[model samples]
Target chain A: MAHPQPPESDPQSPSAPTAPAKSPRVGLFVTCLVDMFRPSIGFATLKLLEDAGCTVVVPAAQTCCGQPAFNSGDNKDTRAIATQVIEAFEGLDYVVAPSGSCAGMIREHYPELFADDPAMAQRAQHVAKRTYELTSFLVDVLGVTKVDAAMAGTVTYHDSCSGLRELEVKVQPRRLLAGVSGLSLTELPGAEVCCGFGGTFCVKYPEISDKMVTNKAEEIVATGADTLLAGDLGCLLNMAGKLKRLGAETKVRHVAEVLAGMTDTPAIGDPAASLPNKER
Target chain B: MQSTSRNFKDNAHKALNDATLQRALLNVKSGFQENRARTVAGLPEFERLRDAGRDIKNHVLANLDFYLERFEENVTANGGHVHWCRTPAEAREKILEICKRREAKTVTKGKSMVAEEIGLNDYLEENGVEPIETDLGEYIIQLRHEPPSHIIAPAIHVTREQIAVDFRREHSDLDPNRRLEEPRDFTDEARAKLRDKYFAADVGITGANFLIAETGSTVIVTNEGNGDMTQLLGKAHVVIASLEKIVPTLEDASTILRLLARSATGQEMSVYTSFSTGPRRSEDRDGPEEFHVVLLDNGRSAMLGTEFQDMLRCIRCAACMNHCPVYEAVGGHAYGWVYPGPMGSVLTPSLIGVEEAGHLPNASTFCGRCESVCPMRIPLPKMMRHYRQREFEKGLSPQKARAGLSVWSYVATRPKLYRLATRLASGLLGRLGKVKGRLTTLPLAGGWTSVRDMPAPEGKTFHDLYRDRQAAKGGRE
Candidate 1:
């Protein structure tokens, strides 16, 4: 596991010529949903970060970020799972996640989880400060606008509710994708609109959920894009499920997967067969 | 006289029958949402702007009384008058008195929702004063004698064809043989007619987007330029609005304006961003002779300390309604109130008691999309839940729903009983599932079955499957 370090420039020194330190160690907090259900995203994050010349590590003990429980008002279960997560990744130069919902849980609510304990709150803040969405981590911290990853397809991005609103993860991803050699970033009509996958909301109220996802699917098809890209796996899965059910051929892939040169490996199950034709 | 409430089934039935309204709604299905996203994408610091917008509203709301006093003083200092009204009747009376004093006969209004809340047009009409709606959307709804379906786009439920018919019937002076061919044609005709009213009217009534305390200016943003022309050409200009519209400084106003335009219409700025500081400066030749600001309280001052204080952060963007599935299904009129959509679901019940609007809260699937897109970042779903709880506590929900909820609550308190009940129900449902894979309708669950099919439950519940699987795997059983 990697631990995020303080910037090398001295806080005490008023005037000093400072050299930007070597790319700090960054551990990919591949969310539990992506790790268990969508392993390609994890591999993509690793490839993208490593390609950028940074030390990368994947902490094995990282589980669910307790978002499912927290959103359900089960504070106790959320705290229990969150504690396990913090303990597992106690030292990391930067704990980064590809999903906006997981990143928000780590950054926004982790402090509340440890509100009773001051030391735990401080530790949670440390993790929160270092944790960044995949695109934000790459663009803001690493200052890398372009990556070697290339693919050919028209893609529109879905702004996951947590990422777009909670963490403001809109531009960083677009900037990175814009720099990619051949990919075209088309705007989905109502792209900032929620896909209506409110975690438990999809199950509890499936009727209304059906209407929302169907609307989203219609909008995605309207964009005339062959692929859908988003930072959060939850939104992608919801959209993908709807698209598949509707028999639409639009494929869903995490933004990290597209940027990591993993397009050659088919995203769903076959890594070798998934690569773009040019890469293969 | 509480005609505001409608039975949930009745509202849905009414909306379903309105084919013309559905056509109109389809035209604007994702209109605002697309525009807002496009506008936000253009600004690099959009999120920072949103945060600042939220903070500014929060600050003004916290010190509302002080700001109101300061605004009142500034308006008075600028040769303008400020009238404080605690109720709708007071607001109506104040406006009437001002009209009576000025001996104003014909008045032109520039699309004010606050005016609708006070029944201002009706009051003026009873007193023999004519009020004309200037905005194209508002004009159609006015001619048709209907309340605004959507707040900003008042006559959103009326189709272009319907408007053409309305204009033909009302504008008898037009050629009876000529056909209304296009929207541009209808708009040009309306523009020609409304231009006359803009100049001929003695007073112009408009709503303020924000009341700036620093310079005592009332800011109005309009795309059609009606608000600008109304204030600039009329003899007297009146702003009958809420106290929550007051902001402390122009900088804060600009920050809000940045978010408001993008959030509402996806415009970098409205076509006419008119700031009327006490009607017009003395040197200004073409401006109203008298200016009046009516700070309306009605039920807002009481909401300041309540759970709904966050609602005051709303800039009337209607982004929530645009993305809401329920709003898409039933349209705005089904809410049976001035405001509609997620914001309306929470607000309608608050303003008109729980008994009158018990169904509004349940109208949502609790999708939480409204909260996500809200520039102010209000927790809309939770506030809606508060309304739902209030309705349930007051015994406003239907008897069957209440009974069903009680049964579930009883089962929830006892885990063993819950498992038994679920197991028995699922087994019966599984047997029924063999006949057809789903139930098209269910007795006593008319609301759920009306819109969709209920999938047949599996023979075993999650608890039962979890226990059996764990035992097979040599884990906890």
Candidate 2:
């Protein structure tokens, strides 16, 4: 593994104008779901960043993005958790999350949460400007259009609500996926609609959530795709769980796992040996 | 109307199980949304028009008192009566008084959500007056003795087959074996039946799309010509509008009108965009002898300066409900009020107490399709969240939900405890589901597991793995 040069040695730094420009330093906000349920996504994100000639660090103090509290209308606790996140991820060149929902929270909502405290509000605004979803960082900020990875499967992508509406992460992932070899993309009907995994909403109103996810599952299965892919883990989990319950043979995985060519792990919610590695 | 919003969960469950309503709801997903999308695509400046509409409403709201007074002055100058009402009971009483004065045995009515808000028809019927719905959809629902299911399409929950059955049940005077298979057949039969009611009606009641302060004119846009007949053929014409419907001028009204029909029914313009300033003049041909405007406050004045003030900008286009996935799934009646869907989720709690309608705001998935499609650019989800905050502050949210949230927040804010708890839980669950990589049932998560399986965690926390990976890499170069 390659290590990034110290900040003082970077040519872009005012202190050392003669030295070569160092790689961009990125702090990975491995969301809580990814940290526990699927560490493979975090590793995949790290590999993608490293392969793009960037230095990636997983900030140890980061836990969750505080969305679960914020969406539940517990703004007081949300502010405290956001304060901790700001303190941990400060001073990095950029903050990137493999999940758009978390990145959207940091980028779109953190500043709104600190509207009363002007000093904290300013710090939050700074951090918010530097935060980007992984695919967005790769395509929009890093300007990398292609990846050195491939997989053989027909997959449909589900655009999660927060990422699609709040952060506008529609074409970034699709643009990168166009570069992968042997992976055909099928369009899912009503792909932009929510799969009803609204943090606490699924459990709070399970019947409504079940109806919405069932509609989404029928649409996904109608496309006849062998695999399902999305950026956010919450939607992926909700969709995968429903697909499994319906006894569909469709495989589910995070887009990063496929983009980074890490298909050795089993597909989400499937039996351990259900899928064999077929990367070409 | 008596609100059953407190029973939103039960209503939603019943609606989900209702087979006919489920089939009728398919029309909303396929018809209005696709039509609006196509119509909006033809107009490149639809978004800019939305901004204009929002700004116009905001300006009027900022100077609401001024425009309202100006409107009242103009109405009085035009030989019209303006009655200010602060409550539904007052508005209903005022309309009843007008009917009593005119000795109106029957009144023909256009589709008015404000009328529904005040429960005017039932109140009139109880007071020995008959209120006949002139709009085709409203007429069908009236025959069935049901409230309007949708704001624009009042009978969207009723299918043509059901309507035919209703007609056969109610219209025993008609031929018992007549064909009623097509929509045109229903329309022709309804038109013939309502023609007599329009002539017999002593008073007309209709809702205003806009109350123009400049011209003292009340506007009603309808695809059917029934609204024109309802106000024209009757002896008196009455317009029932809420306070927020007052716009500054006709130009402002026209600008908002550009977005209304396209948002509501996806038409460039409705078939009849009729405006009535006052009663008929001495030399006039066909017009009402009296004109009255009942301006109802009905808990709207309190929303003018608060976080919910943006909700007052709604034009009632039904776009929010048309695009809402929740409304699409459960249909409109599940909301259990005159207003339904995303707008109802915010406004129901404001009009009715949040305690009575707490489930309305909590039921959404925050998909944001409503806010995206709203012609007036209302931040509906944000307003819904504000209602949630109110519920949270008042301790009106479910006790179990609040307790779970507090416990989770307590653990989440402390990273060390969170990591330890997650590690132990994931390791245990990982072992329990080592074969399938998913759990068929979870102990405490029955809400999730009852409907769908829960995927097991991948054995260890990323923090634990990363720390070990760093130690193996010689302690982070």
**Which model scores highest in DockQ?**
2
For B276-365, candidate 2 gives per-residue lDDT tens digits of: 999998989889999999999999999989999999999999999998888988888889998999999999999988989889988888
Model 2: residues with Cα > 4 Å off, grouped in runs: A1-20, A277-280
lDDT for each residue of candidate 2 in A17-83, tens digit (9 for 90 to 100): 3323467777899999999898889989988987876777787878899988888788898999999
Candidate 1 residue-wise lDDT, B206-289, digit = tens: 989999998889999898999988887778999987888999999988988888888777889988888888866768877889
TM-score for each model: 0.70, 0.97
Superposed on the true interface residues, model 1 gives a C-alpha RMSD in angstroms of 10.0
Query: Which CAPRI level is candidate 2?
Result: medium
Error of 1 at B272 (Å): 0.6
Tell me, by TM-score, which candidate is best: 2
Worst 10 residues of 1 chain B by lDDT: B447-456
